[model samples]
Target: MMAPRNIAPIGYSGGSAPRSGPSGTLGADNRLTTYANTTRRRVDTILELFFADKARRADSDRLPPDIVGALHAHIFAGGSRTRATLCALGWQSNGGQERLPGAVLRAAASLELHHAGVVAYNDLIENQEPRRGIVPLRRMMEFRYVSESLGKQSAGLLGLLTLAWSDELFHGARLTARQRCAAIPVLAEMRADVIYGQLLALTGMDCDLGDVDLALRIVRYKTVGYRYEHPLQLGASLAGANPDIRRTLSAYARPLGEASQLCADLRSVFGNPLTREQPRPEDLQRSRTTVLFNIAAAVADADQRAELLTLTANPDLDATGAQRCREIIETTGAAAETVRMVAQRRALALQALEATPIPMPAAEMLRVLARRVTANIPSSCCLGRGTS
Candidate 1:
C-alpha cells in the first residue's frame, strides 16, 4: 500500500458554465460541461467520428442484420463517450500530437464500444432496463415473452469483440512486432479483470461481508487498470514514455480510477440527475452488486443486517420495498461511510498526482473533471470534514 503526501483539492469557485464547444448543438451541463469545455472541440469531434466509424463497421455485411442493427443502436445511443474522450485527452496531455493517428482514434473508440457492449450485458445480468437514459439493449432486442438470453449473449460477444479491437488497433507492421506483443499482455489483463469483476457483481458476490475487500480488489483490477493506467500507458507507450513516467502515471491513475468508479457506484446507489436515472435499489434483483449493500452489510447489526439482506436477496422487493432499503442504508450511516470512502480514495488520487511531476494545466483539468464526477453525490460533498 503506497501512500503519497498531502495535496489540497483545487477548488472551482466561479459559478460559471463552460463555453460551448464548436459544435454548438451540444451544450455543457454540470460535470460533463467542464469535461466538454476541457476537451470540447477535439474530444467531441473525435467521438462523433468514432461513432460514425463504428456505425459504418457494423453496417458492413460482416455480421447478421439483427446483430448489426443492435450493435449500431447500442453505439449511437446517448453515452457520455467518457472513456474514449479521456483517452484522447490523455494522449494530448502526454505531449502526443494534436492530429492523432487513425489507429489512436480507433483505439479510443474501442473503449467506448467495449463499454457499450458491457452496459448491455449489465442490463441482462441485472434484469434492468435503461442505459444512457434510454431503454437497455436487452429490452430493445429481446422477445418480450421469451427471456433475453440471445440478445444478452450477442451483446456480450460484441463487447468481447470491441475490447479485442483495442489490441488490433495497436498491431501493425508500422510498430515493432515486439512492442505490439508487449502491449497485448497488459491490455488482455485489463479486459480480463473487468470481465471477472463484472461476473462477480452479476453473481451477487459483492454481498458477502468478508468480500468487500475482494470486491474492491475486483474493481481495482477491472476498472482502475483500464480506465486510467492502461489507456495512459498506451498513449505514453505510443509516444515512447520512459518506465519511470509510466509507473508514475500508473500510480496517479489508480486512485483516480478507483475514485471515479466510486462516484459511479455512488450514482448507481443514488440516482443521477443529469442522466435523470434514479439509483436502482433493487439492482440485486438482477444480480448487480452495490456499494450501498456492501457497507450496510458490514456495519448493520444482525437483525438489521438480515432485514437489509432480505431487501437485497429477495427477488420480490418491488420499487417501494427497494426505496425502504435505500432508506435503511441512509439511516444506518452506511451512505455516510460510503461518502467517507469516496473522499479517502479521491484524496489518495490527488496525493498520487502530487508525488509525480505532472504539469499544472493537465493536472488541473483532471482535478476539475474528478470533482465534477463526484459533485452529483451529496455524500461525496459531505466527506465528514465539512469540505462541503
Candidate 2:
C-alpha cells in the first residue's frame, strides 16, 4: 500500500468570515470578491437569467407557471453555490484565462440547478419540515390538489423536473458537441455517486447510527465527490487542464471535501454563531444517524446511551432535550473526536494544496477556501478533546 504524503500544512490560517458577494450574500469563498475573474454573484446571476428565461418559455407553452415558480423559489432559497464556483475556479486556475466563455459559465450554472434538484429530493426523503419550519410548496399543492398524497407526489416530480432543467441548461450551453460529449462522463459519475451515497444513508436511517466508518462513506459520495471532485474535474476538463494538474487537484479535493462535510455536520449540531446555524432539533429528534451520533453511541456509557436513545427517539424532543443530547455528545468526546478528524483532513488538504503548481491567484484562492471549512468551528470544540 502506498503511504500517505507527509506534507506539513503551511500557508493555512483559519478562514475568516468571507465578505458578502455583490448582492450581499455569503458563500463558500472570499476570493470570489478579491479575484475579479469570477464571483458567486456572477454564477448566481447566470442561474437567475436562465431560470427567468425558462419561466417565460414555460408560460408560452401553456405549462404550469406555479411549478416553474416553485422550482425557482427552491433554487434561490439558500445555498453557498460551492459547486458552481468550484467549476469556475477550476477553469480559471487551469489557464481558461480571465474572460471565461459563456459556455463554461452556463455549464457551471447547471451544477447548481442539478444540486437544487437533488436537495429537493432529499427534503422529501428526510420528510422533515424545512428549517424555516413551513413548506409553501407542499402547502400550496395540498390546497390545490386536496390530497396530501398528490402534494407529495407533485413535490417529487418537481424535484425530478429540476434535474431535467439541469440537463436543459447543459444541453443549451453553446459548447461544441465534442466538448459536451467529453464532459458527460464526469456529470454522469457525479449523479450516480450522489444517488448511491444517498441511498446508503436512506437504508441506514433506522437509528442504528452504526459507526464513523459508515457515516464517512456516505460523506465521501454524498458530499465530497458530489460537491468537490466532480465539479472541479468538469471545470478543468473544460479548460483543457493536463493530467498532472488533475492528479494534484484530486489529491487536494478529497480531503478538502471530507473536512468540509465534517465541519458542516459539526456546525449543524453544535451551532455556528458565525453562520448563525443554531442546533437543529429535527436533526437530533429524527434519528439523523450521522457520524457524530455514531461516535457518541460507540463511546457512551450505559446511562448516557440510554438517555441518548430516549432523546433521539422522542417525537417531541424540545430544546431542553436537544441540549441534553449535546451534553451527551460532548461528554463522550464525539464532537472533539470529529473535530480532530476534521483538523487532520484539513491539514492534508492544505499540504497538498501548498505543493500544487497551479497559477498564483488560483492557488492562493484555494488556500483561502480550504481555511473557510473550519472557520465556524467553535473554540469550545477544541476543549472537548479527551473528556471521556
Candidate 3:
C-alpha cells in the first residue's frame, strides 16, 4: 500500500516556473512553491489521463463505475504532494536536469498512484476517521452501496484495485529499458517496506508506548523508508545518480521524516480539535506512545505515571481525564522536550544536506521541504497523517 496522505504528505502550494541550477539564484521560497504547485498539476494531469483511459476500457458492459469514481474523489481530494515533490527534486538533484522530462514526471506520478493505493488501504487499517483527515472514502462507498458493511468492503477492494493500477502506471511511465532496470528493484523494495511498516504499526498498537525506539522505528519504516528515502532514491536511481547522492538523500530523509511525525503528534494532542476534517485525537485515544509521552513517563513521579497509564488508551476518557494527561505532559516538560527534538532533527537534516556535495538548489529545495514539515504546529491541528 502507498499514500501521500498515509505518508507525511505536505500541505501548501503556489509558484511559477523558473529554471535554476544547484548554484542558481532563484529564491528558495519561490522555487519551492513553484515546485510544489508544478508537481501537483503534473500529477493531476497524469491521473486525468489515466481515468480517461479507464473510461475508454470500461464501457457499460465492463467495470462498475462507482468504485473508480470513489477513488477519483479520494485522490483528488488533495494532499501534501510530499512524495511526488521529493521525486522531482531527486531527479533534478546534482544538476541532473533543469526542465523535468515527461518520463520523470510520469515516474513521479507513479509514486502518487502507489501512495493512493497504500493510503486507501491504510484508511481501513487505521480505522480512524474522518478518513484521510478530509473526505471519508469508506463513508463515500457506504453512500454508494447504501450499506455500511458493503461500503467498507468496497473500500478494501478499491485499495487492491488501485494498487494494481499503480503498477500499471509505473510500467507505463515510459522509462527507458535502462531506467526501468535501475528503478524496478527500488520499486520492489518500496512495496515491501510499506507493508512491513504497516505490520509494525499494527503490532505496536497494544505494546508499550513508552519505548521511544520502537515508536521512532515505526515512523522510519512506515514513513521514512518509502515516503522519503525510497521516493528520493527511486527518482535518483531513475536519473542514474551515483550512490553518494543517494546516500545523502537517505541521511536527509530519516531524521526529517521522524520530525514530521513528531510535529503531527504535537498538533494532535495540543492543537485545536475543531479544524475542518479533523478526527478525534487518536494519539491519546490509541496510546501511540510518542516521544512526548515517553519523556513524561521517564520523568514523572509514580502518581503522574499512573495518571498517564489511565488517561491514554482509555476509550472512556472524558474531557477532564484528557486535560489531566495534558497537564502531566506540560508540567513534566515533555511537550517542551518534544519541541526541542523537532528542532534537533531539523538541524540534523539540514546538516546532512550541507555535509554532502549536493547542488545548492537541490539542497535548498529539500531544506524548504524540511522547514515546511517541521514548521511550528499552531493551536489548530491542521496537519494531516495524525500521530502514526
Candidate 4:
C-alpha cells in the first residue's frame, strides 16, 4: 500500500511552524486535536440536553430523586469517550459535513449512554467497588434500598433503564428511514457482541490459563467489535455509507481495535498516566485470564509457570503479589511480546487504511489516533522501564 498523502506535521507551539520532517505530517495533529475537541463538545451538549430532559421529568416521576442524581453523576463521570468520538469520526470520514447535523450528534451521543449501561452492568458482574473513579452505581443506590436485595435489583434496573434511554435517544434523532435501517442492525450487532463476549469471558474465567486463543477471542468480540467496529460502522451507516465502505472501515477497525485493547492491557498492568488514571491490575487480582497473562504463562519456564499459577490462584492478590506477577510477566518477555503485537497490529491497520478509498482527512485522523493509542506502550511498560 502507498503511504498516506497530503499529511502535515503538527506544531506543538503557537505561531511558529516546526521544521518539517521527512513525512511532513505536522499540522495534521492540530487538525485532529481540533476535530476531537469539537466532537467532544457536541457530544457533551447532547448529554446535557438529555440530562435536562430527565431533570424536567424527575419531579413528577415515581423514582426517588437520589436515584436520578446518581444516574446523572455516573454519566458525567469522566471517560475516554472513545465510542462517541469514533462514531463522529466515522460519520465525518464517510462524507458527513463539518457542521454535524443534530440527529447525527444525538445518535453519536447515545452510544455513550449505551456504554454507561454496559459499564454499570459490568460493575455489578465484577462486583467492583468503584467505577469511573467513583463508588459503583450499586453502592450509590444501596442506601436508598430497603434491603440489600432490593438495592441490587435497583442497580440492575438502573442499568436496564440506561439501555432503554440509549434506545430512546437514538430514535429521537431525526434519521431517515434508510439511515435507521442501516444503523439499527449495527447497533444490534454491537450489543450482541458485547453480551456474547461477556458470557465467553465469564465461562472461561476458570478455564485453563494456557488458553490463549480463548483469551484473544474474548478480546476480539469484547474489545474489537463493541468498542471499535460497531461504533465506526454505526457512524458510517448514519452517513449512508455503502456496504463496501462499511466493509472497508471494518478491515481497518479490527486490527486497530485489537491493538488499542492490547495497549490498554499493558497500561492497566504497567501504568498509563496519560489517557486515564491507572487502576490496580484487576485481571491479576480477579485471576482473570487475559492475553498478556496467558502469553507469559505460555512462555514461562516450569518454575515461572508455577509462580504464575500460584499468584493467579489468589482471588485478592495484594499489592506485593501484584508486583511480583508483573515482574514475572516482564521477566518472561510477555510484556515485550505484547508491545510487539501492538506494533504489528498497528502496522496491519495502517496497511489496510492505505488500501481503502476513504477520504484523506478520515484516514489521516485514524492514523493519528492509532499512533496516539499505541504511542507510549513500549516506553512505559518495557521490561527495563523499572515498572513506573
Question: Model 3 shows how many backbone clashes?
Answer: 7
What value does the lDDT take at residue 222 in candidate 4?
72
Write the residue-wise lDDT of candidate 4 on 1-388 in tens digits.
1112222222111122323554536566566667766676677777877777787788787666667678887776655467887887789767788667889889988998999898887777777776334677777777676566777778889999999999999999999999999999999999999888878877887787768789899889876897888888999998988777787789888988888878777766776544344447565654356788788777788999998788767777777888888888888888888888888898988887766578888888788777766665635456532211
Question: Which stretch of 10 consecutive residues in model 2 shows the poorest summed lDDT?
Answer: 1-10
TM-score of each: 0.77, 0.87, 0.86, 0.87
RMSD of each: 8.0, 7.7, 5.7, 6.7
Q: What global local distance difference test value does model 3 have?
A: 0.73
For 27-64, candidate 3 gives per-residue lDDT tens digits of 77577866677677777788888886776666763787
Instruction: lDDT winner between 3 and 4, please give it.
Output: 4
| Model 3 residue 27 distance off true place after TM-score fit, in angstroms | 2.2
Ranking by TM-score: 4, 2, 3, 1
Q: Residue pairs in steric clash, candidate 2?
A: none
Model 3: how far residue 242 lies from native, Å? 0.5
Best by lDDT: 4
lDDT tens string, model 1, 195-294? 8877666554544652457557767865777667776666566555566656767776787777667666666656654445665656544323555556
Best by TM-score: 4
**Best of the two (3, 4) by TM-score:** 4
Question: Candidate 2 — which residues are off by over 4 angstroms?
Answer: 1-30, 34-38, 59-62, 132-147, 275-277
Relative to the unseen true structure, what is the C-alpha lDDT of residue 5 in candidate 3, on a scale of 0 to 100? 31
Local lDDT at 211 for model 2: 73
Candidates' C-alpha lDDT: 0.58, 0.74, 0.73, 0.76
